[model samples]
Structures are given as structure tokens and as C-alpha cells.
Target chain A: MSPRRGTRRLRLSDPHRRVRFGLAVVLTVLTIIGGRLVQLQGLDGMKYAAAAEELRLTRLDLPAARGQILDRDGNALAYSVEARAIFADPGMIVAPGRTALALAPLLATSADALMGELTADGRFVYLARGLDPAGAQAIMDLQLAGIGELVEQRREYPAEWTAAQVVGFVGQDDTGLAGIEDQYDDVLTGTPGQLVYEQGRFGLPIPAATHSLEEAVPGSDVQLTLDQDLQFTLEQALAVANENAGVSSAQAVVLDVATGQVLAMGGSPGYNAADPGGVRGDQLANPTVSHVIEPGSVNKMITFAGALEEGLITPETELTVPDNIAVSDIVINDAWGHAPIHFTATGILGKSSNVGTVMLAQQLGNARLEEYLRRFGLGTATGIELPAESNGILLPHEEWSGSQAGTIPFGQGVSMTVLQMASMFQAVANDGVLVPPRIVDQVIGPDGTVIDQPGSEPRRVLEPDTSADLRYMLESVTNEGGTAPLARIDGYRVAGKTGTAQRPNPECRCYAGGGYWATFAGFAPADDPRYVIAISVEQPGGSGGGGVIAAPVFTSIMSFALGDNGVAPTGTPSPEFRLTTDED
Target chain B: MSALPAYDRPQRVAGRRTEPTRVSLQRPVAAPAPAGRAPFVALILFVIGAGLIALLVLNTAIAADSFTERSLSQQIEQLRLQEQELQQEIGAAQAPAALARAAVEQGMVPAGPPGFLIVHPDGTTQVVGEAKPATRPPPPARRN
Candidate 1:
């Protein structure tokens, strides 16, 4: 080889030139890449990321569980449970008719309705709102495309119609529409939440991906003071009472005298809380608090209370009472005809003498009677934890006409709720102290914290001696000679009053062709006076009175109340009552 | 043994016999070698390969766990539904109306007035109320 020639010949491909070329190419590529990075990371980043998330992310709205309504004994009166609802994505459905046919039987709905829903021009349609777990599983096993089930809730009323009026019902959207459910809607309903996560290709959440949960807070439970079993008994008895063709509706309530807790309250024509849609809208309300009636002889107690409080007469004071009396332009008469008789104040109340009561009222005057009426928690809502309570009609003392003065004393012109009538006797039964009745005993939080309701403040309505005297007087009504012998419980002594008042006709706006409200208010073991019960029946086309219609029911309930609570009679012998100074 | 016969046969075929190659040693003889970098290179390759396999296994485990978690969640949802159904059944069976209806079906009648037995402090028992002999009631009203 020629080494001199090789050295002299120019090296055409020099290392320096190759190095420069490589550097230039690398610099140009790096510049391009850097420019692309800036464009991607700075300017269009937000819009791109949002688009990607929109494709890969899914958000779900989680509804919190509604609280339960429990009775005093920790029994569930109403509860909400998660159920499944059948929905269809019409756009994804291949054959609407076939899918509907397969789903109709499981969903318990018409095939035609489902077909219409499945073919509707929307992305989603509900074929059934609630399906049990087994039924939902059956539908899912069919694996029909476009048909899917989602979690929903169904409110179950296990007690059925027992305390339906007091416990109330919920609407389709889980909103409380009536009763305690409606009154404590905020307490029973909870806050909603959201769950957001990145979705994988198979509709499952990606592992360790971005996930967030805004948790839902469940509602607190509200426990009522009602006794479930006693409520059932009252409901059963009231239902039987309403079976008469003449009777339109009936109502009843029982209370604990000391605590003023409503142990049981019910009415006829009650709706099932689980299925409120089957009944008339007007019938869904609790008539005991919402409806009013001329309280009749049930109102005489207040008049007598006022007289005794004002030192007008003692139980043994004798008075000459006639069959009828003319006060202002109206002539009021007793239910039975009688000549002038000398009788004690106890006999006047025990016999439910309208004329005698008015005579005492005349002595007491209107202001004092109205004042007594107000003190009995009348002419106003009872401030109970119920919705749509009525403040019954009681004319202010200044607004009383002449005839009103006569009849108002005997509860003819005056109208009050059944609850008010019951409360009147409660004051006497509780030794002259008045405690406003309450239905809710306490509230239980979701996390197991207990919130007790403040005890109701009781006020004095009558002196203790006057209350004792009243109890002695009222007990005569359930005896042999007085009215309402059927109200006599077997073992315990019962004290009660009976009222039969004519109702005003709605069409005529008068008393011509109206009905009569037969009412009974009483308490058992009259000496101790533990439980107070009141019942009423409205007979629109009948001639029966409270003794005939209302007293028997009271007997059934009062006997049970005494026996169920295991209350013992005082065993004190009954003292002889001087009903008449001239003994018959 | 068959291969030796073939080799003899080729040799006997004389005209196509292969020539024996001559072997010679080089002038610059190789040094007695110490251990070379080949083993180290092999070790590095093995470590890189092992690390890559471990990464693959970890990723597979995570993906599998994600799938298991999804199935478990679905199972949990089904169990929740089952619990709800059971609760509903219990509530229905224990409801007062249902009990009354059941009692009627079993030839049981609603009780009348209840009586009490008074126990005196001296260990004497006396019936307080009249315990009326039970009579058959009128057929129960058709209740729901």
C-alpha cells in the first residue's frame, strides 16, 4: 500500500464535518419537540384534560336513608328500605315489545304501559318504582339489554292501619305528606351526597384512580309516645263502631294522666300509611285534631269547674232544676222531661242536666266561663307535634250573643276538637294540673345519640280539692242511676261524662237535618286516675246518644287500659252520693 | 455405530475423501486469562431481566386486585338488598294487623275485658274483677 499517497489524499468524509451535521440535526429536532411540549402543556391543556375526563369519569348521586318512625316500645311504625326500580334506556333497546313482555310479570305492571315507556323518546324511563330484591334479581337474570334496575326506597308501614292517622305517610319522592312524617320532615329526611370516580373500559372504576365521595348523612329517628298494642285495640273498637250505617266516622284517644303523653289516639276511616293513594285525600288527615264538633255535655265539666273555682256551689249544695230554661231568645231543655226537683250539684253534672248547668253558668257569668274555657286549652291548637291542628271556634267573651251565652255554657254554640274534649277530663284526672299532650317522646340520632324532648310545662287549672270534688262528682255518671253505665269497667272505677249534640247541616248551614255527635270522655280507677280515654261517634242519620253508642266502646278500652298496665283498684268502698235532697 | 460405518464408507469412496487440515500455533501467544467482563455483563442482563419481570408481576397483581374489588362491591350491593328484604319480612310478620288476622285464622278470638288477681300482703290471693266465662265472638270484621 502507498502510505505517502494515502496521507496526501484529502480525507473527503472528515470527522469534524460529520460532527457538525449531527449537532445541527439534533438541535433542530430538540427545538421542534420543545415547541410541541409548550403548546400541549400551556395553551390547550385545560380543554384537552376536560374532554378526557368527560369521557372517562362517572358521577353518581347517593341519597341518604330516611329515619324510622318508632313507637314508645321501640316498635317500628314506619320505616324506609332500599328497593330496586326498573328503568329502560329506550335508545339502547333493540326490541321494545319483547323486552316489555319479559318484564311485565316481574314488575307487576301492564305490558302495554311498559311498552309505551320503553319506546318513549327519552334516554331513561321508569317502568316500576319499587320491586323487591327477589323480583329485581329475576329481572336482572333475564339480562335484557337496555333494561336495568337501580336502587330506590320504599316506605313500609308494618303496623298497617293501627296508628295510621298519627304516624302518617310519605309521598313517592320520600317527602312526608301527613302526620308525624310531615311534622318532622326535616328530622326524618337526610342530606344527599355525590360519588365521583374514573371509569375503566368495562364500566368498573379504575384501580387507584381519582375517586372522591361527598358522604351522605342519614336522618335522625323520631319516636312517638303512642302504645302500639293499645292503639290497635282502639282502632279495632273504633272500626267496629263505624260499621253502623248511621255513623260516618269515629275517633278516640287515651293519655297518661301524669305525663300527658298520648298513649293511643285513633279514628275510623283511617288510611294505610303504606298505601295512602288508595283513599280519598280528605280522609287522609287525622280527624281528631282537624275536625270539630259541638262538644255537648262533654263541655259541662268546664262550666262546673268554673262554678266550683269561683265558690258558686259545692257538690252537696241543693238547687231546684226544671226541665227547660229560657236564656235570651233560646229555650234549652234536658234530653229527658222532668218537673222541678231539688238536686245537688253532683246530680246536675252526673245526669248531664243542660238547664241546671246553664243556671250555674248564669251565676258564674260569660267572662268567667270563657276564662275557664281558655284555661282548659280550648279555642286554640293543642300545640301538639301534629300538622294541620285546628283552633276550635270559641267566640271571645265580647263576641257572645245572648243565645250563645246560654248554649256556649253547655257546648252547643261552642265547637272544639276531640283532643280538646279529652284534655278537659285530663286536667281533672291529673289532680287539677294541665299538661299539654305530646306525641313525640324523643329523637334518636343516626350515630346512636339520644335527644330527649323537654318535658311539657304543666300549669294549674283548678285547686287540688276542687279536682277531687270533680272526680267524685263525675264518677256518679258511670253508676246505676246516672248515664253511661256501660262505661263501668269490671275491676276499676271509671269516671266519665257523656255528650250527645246535634251537628249543623252543611248544605242548609243550620241544625235542621244535621247529625248528632255522641261523645264520651273518662278515666279509669277514678280515685287514682291513671289513664284518661275519650271516644266519639258521629251519626248523621241516627237517633242514638253517647250513652248508647260511645260508652260501650269506652268500657272496652278503659277495661283493657287498666288491665294491660296492671293498675290495681284502690279497693276503697264507694261513698253514697246524695243525688237528690228529695230522694226520687 | 451407524455413523462410524458411514465414515468408513466415505473413506472407502476414495475419490471424494476430505483432506486433513493442518494446525499451527501463532507467534504472539495469548496470556493465561483472568476472569473477563462477560460474567458481569451476563449478571447485569439477568438483573435487568429480573427487575422487568417483577414490574410485570406487580402491575398484573394490581390489575387483578382492581377486578376483585369490583366483584366484591357488586356482591356487597346484592347483600344489602337481601338485608332490606329480610327486614321487610320481619316487619310485616310482626305487624299488629297481621297478627290479628293470623289469630283469627287460627280460631282465636279477640279478648274481652281483662281481670286481675289481687295478692294480699298475708299471702292470700283473691280475684279482684269478675272473670266472665269467655263466649264465642261474632265473626271478625274482614280486616286487611
Candidate 2:
């Protein structure tokens, strides 16, 4: 090629050179893409996938509702109500001063305080907690972007004062503060759920995308074993007794003899469950289980049982009742003002002869009497599944002496809780089955599952025949001319004993009239015992004995309870005996 | 050179130019303008990814809130059960039935007002009264 031609060869830089350069650049880009692809697809894929998953799924604990407590007929004694809590996001409050001003009046708080809270740099703060749905809605209507609401649960007692002592109340944190609430809290609470969501830098949710959702679980409902009508009757009767007897307080308890289930348990000066602050500290304690009182002549039932079980006496056994019997230095007397007269063993009970009881106790001796008392569940707690039960004051064998025996036979020198007393009578009423008393029926789980079944054990305490004999004799106490005539119910045969225990004087070591515990314990429809009721009026001024104060109260409560429970009348006549056969 | 008239310098192959235009000159030459559809298409994909993430977050938040609410509700319920049990205990403790039972266990026997046959100065035992009078008629009011 000529130089001129080479020089002048407007070597049109090959036009395809630009194409080749673009190709080179494309090739370089492809290499980079391949390398980056290997890094992401081969190595970072798992990491990024994990990050994506982290944003998608959230695990949540689902909380369940506590159990509902219901009556035997499935009436709601206590239940839960839904409420809402109001909160705020300080950052979102567009105008802190204005928001506070708007919320102050509705929140029932000072505007300045609300402003301080809103203006605080905190991300979140509670403006109001535990507000009802309506209150929450009112706050929401303010349309303050910073405001938030959360739904919660609060407790509600329907029959506010009906079963106040039995239903208990809760604290602000929903913890069981007192009563059944404290005992069954674990069974009523449930697990909660958590949620995980992929959030953007601003934390706002992206619309219409797949996300993990964990639905919350609800708690369980509980059912109780209380009878509302019976409870009401018992409370009213106790109030009346307290008023008429001039007693500081009175209490009544009704139980199903066979089942040991407490049907009605109440006392005078009862506290309301919704507001428990009004209850006095002393009254707050369940006096029946914790307070110890010396049972008066009612203890004679034990003496009579001892005498009958030993075959030492029958209803026809004869004894002479003097106006008074001298036992060493002490003189014992009869409540009935009878002259030295002929009487039978049953007559002794009817007349409530302290000397006769002492004679019976002397025959049994301290060892046998103590053994019987122990067998009857004295000197020990009933273990009734309640908090703070007292074992009652049972004099040790060392404390027992010949003189103590005579005195104890007439109901003195010992103390017992009301529960222990009721349980003992329940034993007799149940035809000798001394089943452990039960307050809680069953514990239910949050998911409506039965968690635990309580009170399934039944213990045979006395022979059926012995119990029947005792019942027959007890009925006479409420008959004409008997000490507790007022205890008799018109349409039903009732068997009961009255106790007018003199409160011992700490100074004189003797009982005084100023402090008397008039007590009545019995079972109704005597032939077929369905309910056993016990009542006592403490320090009933001038009422003197169980017949005057306690027996009438028992009659009132027992009749109402029997009728409320639809108990059929006992068709069989109460067993009777004639004491005229006693030899003089 | 005839000024390379119509086919000058082989017309620079019709695609080749001696220099780029001023408007094109100011344009970044490091890389060609991205395809009109690619970046926008990539942006759409990013938006979809973002939306999915947002949905996941929202669902997670809702689930968590529900769980919290349920847990609080359960707490409230348990508290209620405890309250009921306690209340029942209080009732039982205060029940007169229990009190009476306690009396019986303590060997207590009910005592009624004692009846009396008051003996007068005539040396005869006769029933003087059904109920006792603690204070007599105060000597006929002292005949004031």
C-alpha cells in the first residue's frame, strides 16, 4: 500500500468500533453481574432469607380468661367484664399543648399534667389505664393521632352482697387479693400470644402482604357450688339474730350432709365484694374457721353419743335430777328449775342437767372422752381448703383432771372453731359419714377444661344406728317444754341441740353472763337429712341461752334453706319417748 | 480534496460523528442512560417487597396486641376466681351454722331463763311469778 494511500486512507475508524466498545462494556457488566450473583445467591441468600423471615413471623402468648364462679343452679355469682385502656405516643401528638387540653377534661385530670406527659420525649405513656370501652371511644374520638387503646378484663360481682364473703375481690393488677380469688388464681389465668411483623424504617405497616398472625387464646370459666337464695336467707337471718340478740355479730352455715358441700355460709356485718375496705380487720377473718369459742350445752350431744355408744344408757335409763348436785367443792345445777325429781337419760338431756352430764362424763373418764372428741375432729383443723384455718383449743390430756371432766361435760374449759362444730354435726346428719368439708367444687382451666376435682373423699365417722338414735333424742329438744322449742319447724321434723355457753371470766376463772355464745346446731326433715344448719349469736345480751337467741335463728334459717332447696318434708314422725317410766 | 462532498470520508459510515453535541456533551458519559423501563420496573419490585414486609409487621403487631389483651384478660379472670374463693371462706368463717357447731363441740348446753317458785313469808312454796322483776314497785312511789 502506498504511503499516500495509507495516510489519506480516511481509515474510517471502523464504525463497528463503537459497537465493539459497547460490547466490551457489556461484557465487563456481565462479569460484574455474575460475580455479584454468586455472592448473593450462593452466600448471602440464607442470611437475607432469615432476615425476611424475621420480619414475617411473630410468636405470641395467648392469654385465657379465668373461670366463672356459678351457683349450684348455674347462676353467675361472679364474672368478668371487658374494659379498655387508653395510652398515648408523645411523638405523634401533633400539638402537645392542644392535645393535653383536649384530653384533660375527658381524662378527669389537669391539663398541665397531661401536657407535661405529652411533651415528654418518651415514645409511649399511659394516659389512662383500665378505662371502659366507652371511655376509650371518647378518647379515640378526639382523633389525636398520638392516642392508643388496649382492651382489658375487669371482674364484676353480680350479687354484690349476696355471697360477699364467698366470692372475694381482686386487686388492680388482677391478682387474687383475698378469698377464693387468691386460692384459684393459677387455674384461672392463661398464656398470652406474641406477634412478629416486618416493619419499615418508619414502623408503618405495608398494605396487603403476607404476614404471620398468632391468635390469642382465651381463659376458662369457673363454676362454684353455692346456692344464692339459701345464702341470702342465711345472711338475713344472721342479721336478725345479731339485732334481736344484742350480739356483736352472728353467723350461719348450711351444708349438704352427704356431700359435705357448703350450700350457704354467711355472717352478720358482711362486707361487700366490690368494696372490701369497709370490713373490719376482725370481721374480715372467717370467724367460723379461725375464731375459737367454748361450745356450751351443745357439747352434751357428744356426751350423749358417748353414753349411747358405750351401751351405758338408753332413752329409758332412769336417774334422779336434784335441783343441784354437789361435786366436791363445786355445786352443779340444772337449767330447768325442777326439784329433786325422777328423770330418764333423755330427760336429763331435755332438762340440760349439768350434774347428769358430769355423771355421764365421769363414767366415760377423761381418756375415753378425749378419744371421742378427737374422733369427732376436735383439736384439729377440718382442712376445708381455705386459708388460715384454726385447729381450735382442745385441752391436752395433761390439762384434764377429775374436776375438769365434770366441768367439761357441761360445756366449759375448751374451745372449738365453728367449722369444726358444723363438721361434727354434719357427721351425725350424714348418717355417720364425716366427709371432709369442701368449699371449692372444682378448679377449671382457662380453656374450659376441668383442672382439678376437689372434695371427693368420704369418711365414715359414726355408726348409722348410733347417729339415728342421737338424731331421735335431739328432736325432743325442740318439742313442747323443751329448751329450744322455738327451734321447731311447723311442717318439718327438726333435730337439734342448743348451746348457751358462758364466756369464762379471765379474772375469776368462772363463766359470766355478760359474754354468752348462744349456739344451735341441727338437721331438718329429721327422717331424711338433706341439709344441716348451724347458727350462733355471740354475747347476746340477756337472751340467756341457745333457745332464746340461737334456736329461733336456726329455725328461721333452716326453714328458709329447706324451702329454697326444694327439700321435701319428711313424712315419718319424729321418734318419741315417755320419761314417766323413770323410777323414783 | 473536493471537501468530501456527499460521501466525504466515506460519510463516516453514517453512524460515526467527529464530535458529540453540546447538549449530549454535558450529559454524563460514564454510562449510558439506563433503559427507560428497567429502573422503574426494579422500583416496582422494591415497592412490592416493602409492602410484603409492612404487611408482615402489621400482622405481627396485631397478633402481639391480641395476645397481650388476652393475657391481661386471663390475669383479670384468675384474680376474680381468687376473690370468689376468699369471699366464700369469709362467709363460711362467719356462718352461724359453724358457730353453733363449735358450741356443740365445746360441750355447751343451752340454758333457758331459769323458772322459779318464790317462797313468800307465809312459809309456803308457791309460784310467785313467770318472769322476774329486778326492781319492786318502789314502796308505792313513796306516797309523794
Candidate 3:
């Protein structure tokens, strides 16, 4: 069919019409796109950009390094070392048994244990913690697919067994477990930080992406008042005493009499701090602050001091004493059998006469005796900066049994720690002032600012004159015929007491046979005491006398301590004291 | 009208004479003044392009520095670890047991009772308690 007239005329006969229509369509589309572009790019750009950046950002936690424990001379007793912990993504690990076998030797773990950890139903699991750098690096070099490493701090005690009880140890999670570590945990642990940055698709950080870091703050360093040299000496002495006396355990503590700082404190059979896993739980406790034993004749010093303070007796007061005194169905005797004799207070203490001491305690009575015991820091924790300290056992005057008055006077019914016993003598050595023993001396902050730990204030327990008289009387105990003549240090006037008390049987609440606590508490240069040493030997196998077993240990430790610290001896001669009375 | 003189009539070309031969009157239109060179706009565009290129280079440099910074940080961490390890070694060496063992290996023994030299205010020095040397010498050197 022929085309219609209008269609033939309109259809492409004029090319300009087609071009004009195309231009108009192109312009209309461009106008629509330009309007939308203005709305998006100029008005809503920031929000979209922020959302895009947010999807790419990641936050990482930064761990802080734990603090170090230093000795008085800046020796690192305990410190945190950098280490790596190995962890596994159990779901990602293939052949858990094979992987465990491969990692066993490097991790120092058994294959079965590692396999158990690996086959556990969890996304993430720790295979090993606190591995050394070399060991962790070796495992990392294995290129195990699911294994990864995290940097962590491992606590280390370089001195090993030296002062182990005081420095303590940390657990696998870097938490303090005992000793000063547990006591000062908050101060030792630092604040962790955060790292915020953009990461790419494969979890790698995007280069030039926004990054913000809040740096981790390291913990402060704690300085203890312990002198490591003296600590070594004390430990050695205790070890030797234990071996020589065939005792179950031995303990010794040396304190700076003036400052009440624990210069050295230790017990034999100490556990290694680095390898605490195999140690007994009881061995981990610091026995110097925890173990309580009857103070024996050492408690007589308190009785005499109480008597002297109350003006009930003088160093020259004469008394007619018998070999044994019977009081309320119990008979107390001197450590050695002696006749009824005239004795002065000094002679009584020198001889360690239980009869003489009970006579003096009878004059002071139970009320005054209990008050003096409490005043000397008994029946309460000394508030030292150590964990698991015992308050010791000091029964009230009303709680005493009929025979307790007699036995307690001679130190049978009372008990105290070696540290408390040392502190008691410290009061006498420090001129009638009782200063609480302190282990920590200073804490240095991360920014190099030092905070000195103020020691506990001294409390007056006795008059200066009373302490002087006590010192004079105690010196006679180490004199020529005194009970602890072996405790005498040549060229120095020594003042101390000897104590030998039978150990109480746990099964039956009575004194056990052939088990005695031999103890000696004293200070050297008696005229001007510098250091106080207290030594206790438990259950000396043969002749368990404090004078025979504990006194020599004190002499050795005191001599070394004085010599090491360069304390000069007092040149004045010790005054003469009569052990045998003229009326006898 | 009357017949005009042939000399005064306008001249026409041959082909258009068939339709009404219209005389075309034309006035000379001045050509537009040559457009001034827009060098300022060109210079601005050039500056913008150059700035974009400079920014691209600077951004690449910063990215490269970030990688370098990461590498340096890693190296610093390694050095810190090494420092701690060396400190651990020193601490081990200085431990009392190690020192005592070393001293024993070197023909030395623990000190005996230490004597003191007292310096009097009057310039007289007195030695108290004779300082005895440790009689036990170190064990004979190991042959192996």
C-alpha cells in the first residue's frame, strides 16, 4: 500500500527536526542527574563518608607491662618479662592430634594434654601461656594455620629461692598469688590501652587510614626494705641450723632496730618462687609471719619488763627461789635443776629460772601480764605488708586456766610468730618504742616520681629507763655463766634470751615429748643496739636447748649481719653480773 | 509609471530574472573584536590540575610513611623484648646463688667473722675481732 500523505511528509524528510528532538531529550536527562548530584554531593556527603569509614575501622586492646619488685638496693627480686602466649582457633585447626604432637616438644607440654585442649569445642583456646621468646618463636615459625601468638608479661623471680616467700609468685593469668605480690596487686597492675585504626578486607591495617592510639601505662615499681645480702645470710643460717640440729624447720629474722625494717627474714625448706607448681601450699606461706610457736623463755623478757615498769622488781631485787614451784596442780622448774638459792632478777633471767620468772609474774599478776603482752604487739596482726600474717594467740586474763598463770609466765601457754618475737625485742632495742615491721620501703611511679612508704609510727610500750634496765638484765643472759653464753659475740656486748618450750601435740592438746622449740631473740652491741636477730629451731633432735641450738645460729647470723652492714662494736665492756647469789 | 531610462535601472543576474528580480541592499557589519585571550581561567585550571597531582603524590608519600612507621614500631617492640631478655640475663648472673657459685669456682669462700676498723675521733684506729680469711679454698679446678 502507498504511504499516507502526512506520514510521508513528516517522516525524516527534514533531518533538523530529529536532531532537535535528540538534543531536548539529552538536556532533560542531564538536568535530572545534576539535581540529584547536588543533593548528594553537597548536602548528604558527610554522613555517607562517615558510615563508610566506620565499616573499615577496628579497635585493638593494648596490654600494659606489670611492675617490678626491687630490693632496698634496687636489685630486682621479682619482675615481669616480655613473653608470648600461644592460642589456637580450634575450629580452624586441622588434625588436632597432629598439631598437638607437633607443638608438644616446643611448648614443653604433653601431647595428650595439648590434644585435649586443641580438640575442645571452642573457637579460641590457649595452647600455652607465658612461653619464652625463643620457644614461642619456634612454634610460630612452624606456620601452623590456626595457631597465633599474643604478647604477654611473665613474672620472674631471678633470685630463685632467696626471699621467695616475700617476693611471692604470679599465676598463669598474671595475677599475684602470694606475698607482696598479692598485697600490692592493684598498685602493680597497670591500665590497659586501646588502638583504633582502619583495616582492609583481609584484616590488615589499611595504609594511611585514620589511626588513634591510647598508650598503655606501665605499673609502678615497688622497693622492699629487705637487704638481699642479709637475706642470703639469714637463709643460709637457717638452713645450717636446720641441718645441724636435725630440726623439722628453722626460721630467722633480722630487723633494723631503728627503723623496724625487715632487713632479712627467711625460713628453711623454702620453695623456689620460679617453680611454684611443685611446692606444698603450706610451704608457700611465709612462716616468719605465719607460723606461731610458744615463745618459751623469750617471753620472760616481757614479764621482767612488766615487773620493771611497774616497779615491782629491779635488776638487783633479791629473791629466794627454789628448784621447782608448784602452782594450781602444775609444777614449773628451771631448764636446769638447781637448789633453793638466793637470786637477783638479773641472775634469774641469766639462769632462765622458770621459778624466778613465775615469782615475778605472780607479783605483776594476770591482769598486768595480759596488758603487757598486748602492749608488746601480741594478739594482733603486726600489720606488715605481707600476706597471711597471723595475729598470734594471746588469751585474755579471764580465759586463763588455773595452771595457765604459772605456765604462761614461763611462756608455755602463749604463742607468737618469729616476727612478733623479734618485734618484741625490737621495742627494747629501739629504746622502749615498738615500731611495726614493714617490708615495702618505696613505690616508684611510671613517670619516675618516687613515693616513699612511711613506716608505722612507733608506740611507747615501756619507759626508756625500763628498757635500759631490761637491756642490762638481758645482757646477763649472754654473760659468762648465762643460759645463752654461746650467744655472746666477741668484742661486743650481746643482749638476748634463750627459750626452749615443748611443742604441743596436735592430736592431744598437751606438750609432746622430745619436741621442743629452741629460740633465741637478741641484739648486738647491747649498749647501742643496731640490729635485732631472732632465730627459732623447731624440734632439735638432740638436746633441744635454745642455748645449744638456737643461740649459735643467732651468733652466726648476727655476726654476719653486723659485719656486712659495717656496724662498729661498742668498745665499752659489759658490766659484771653475779649468776650465783652471795646468800647461797 | 512611465518607462524609465535604461541607464538608471538596477542590473540583475541572468538566472533569478525569471522570478521577480529583487534588488538586494546590504550594509557592512563590523567583525567582532577578536576575543581577549582567557589566560587567567586557563592558569586557574592549570593550577587546579597541578594541585591535584601534588596532592596525589603527597598522599602516596604519607601512605608509604605509615608502613615505615609500622615497621619501626615493630622493631622498637623487638628491641624492648631484647632489652628485657638481657636484663633477665643480668639478673640471673647477679643472683646470690650464681654469684656464690662463681665465687666458689674462683678459689674463694664465704667470708669468716668480719672485723671492724674503728676510727677514733682522736685519729687512732683500732681493729676489733681479728678477721679470719675463709680457710676452705675452692675445690681443685675441674680437669675437664
Error of 2 at A122 (Å): 9.0
**Each predicted model: what fraction of the native A–B Cα contacts (within 8 Å) does it retain?**
0.70, 0.00, 0.52
Which has the better TM-score: candidate 1, or candidate 3? 1
DockQ of each: 0.38, 0.02, 0.27
Better of 2 and 3 by TM-score: 3
Question: Candidate 1: which stretches are off by over 4 Å?
Answer: A1-39, B1-51, B118-127, B136-139
Give candidate 3 misplaced runs (Cα > 4 Å).
A1-55, A110-113, A200-208, A452-454, A540-543, B1-38, B136-144
Alpha-carbon TM-score of each model against the true structure: 0.88, 0.69, 0.86
A284: Cα error in model 3, Å? 1.1
Question: Residue A126 error for model 2, in Å?
Answer: 6.0
Candidate 2 segments whose C-alpha is farther than 4 A from its true place: A1-62, A87-129, A143-148, A199-217, A325-330, A401-403, A451-456, A504-514, A540-544, A579-584, B1-144
Worst 10 residues of 3 chain B by lDDT: B1-10
Residue pairs with backbone overlap in model 1 = none
Error of 3 at A462 (Å): 1.5
